[model samples]
Target: MTNAAHIRLLTTLEHSLDSGQQVVSLTNDEDPLTLKDRVDRIERIELHFPHFTDGRAYSQAYLLRRRLGFKGDLRATGDVLIDQLIQMKRTGFSSAVLKDGVDPADAQRQFERFPAFYQSDVASETPVLRPGALEKPE
Candidate 1:
């Protein structure tokens, strides 16, 4: 589904609770609660990017998945570009809402280029160093 079709924009905490539907909102600079606390009750949490230059949402997506252990869908909204689709997916965003003028088909094409999982070490417990880092072979 398209990001615009699935995402809830400018959604407030109270409104989200009342609607009982998944919501995604922009992070205010002064919020004291942790990301986990903010999204704990919601079925899905989305991070917003007001502009391409503002990248705080990327960090939020990473924290929501890697640190807070959020399993539900994480989406990216606003100023989303075709170039950013792959990186956004890699950072843990399951989907995104592109800007008003952009084409969804382009975004879909970008999303298809990368594999589902990007990190090689995610499946392994130990860190793997370079081949010649330890010693030379005979």
Candidate 2:
């Protein structure tokens, strides 16, 4: 029921999962909601930004988190940069594979540059200084 051309093009989540690979890739054109029904089988989802300006992956990451409730690793692979790491984290990317020439040390510095966030995102449950903002409460 399968053809070599199709098999060469797409391996599918089911096949990857069965092969013991926990991670999967999603292009910008691929709708994140399409995975909502298959989230359980996905352990990690890699969202490709393609270009730093191409922000469709952020929405994909958001939907994967808030909608599909994907809690596993959300990795930013394509066009990854220090300038976008924070936002990527906010959008639920746990890890990122930066493009060449970007130093990992600089990435860590960027993460530390902002002590708190102003808006609620997947990485932060609440805005900074707001009630119940990363605090146990008095």
Candidate 2 lDDT, tens digit per residue, 97-131?
Answer: 65666656666766667768677878779786676
Per-candidate count of clashing residue pairs (backbone under 3 Å)? 0, 0
Candidate 1 RMSD to the correct structure: 7.0
Off by over 4 Å in 2: 1-20, 131-138
TM for every model, in the order presented, reads 0.63, 0.77
lDDT of 2: 0.70
Predicted candidate 1 versus true structure: per-residue lDDT over 80-138, tens digit per residue: 77787666665667656656666556656664565344233212223355456589778
Q: Best-fitting candidate, measured by TM-score? A: 2
Clashing pairs in 1: none
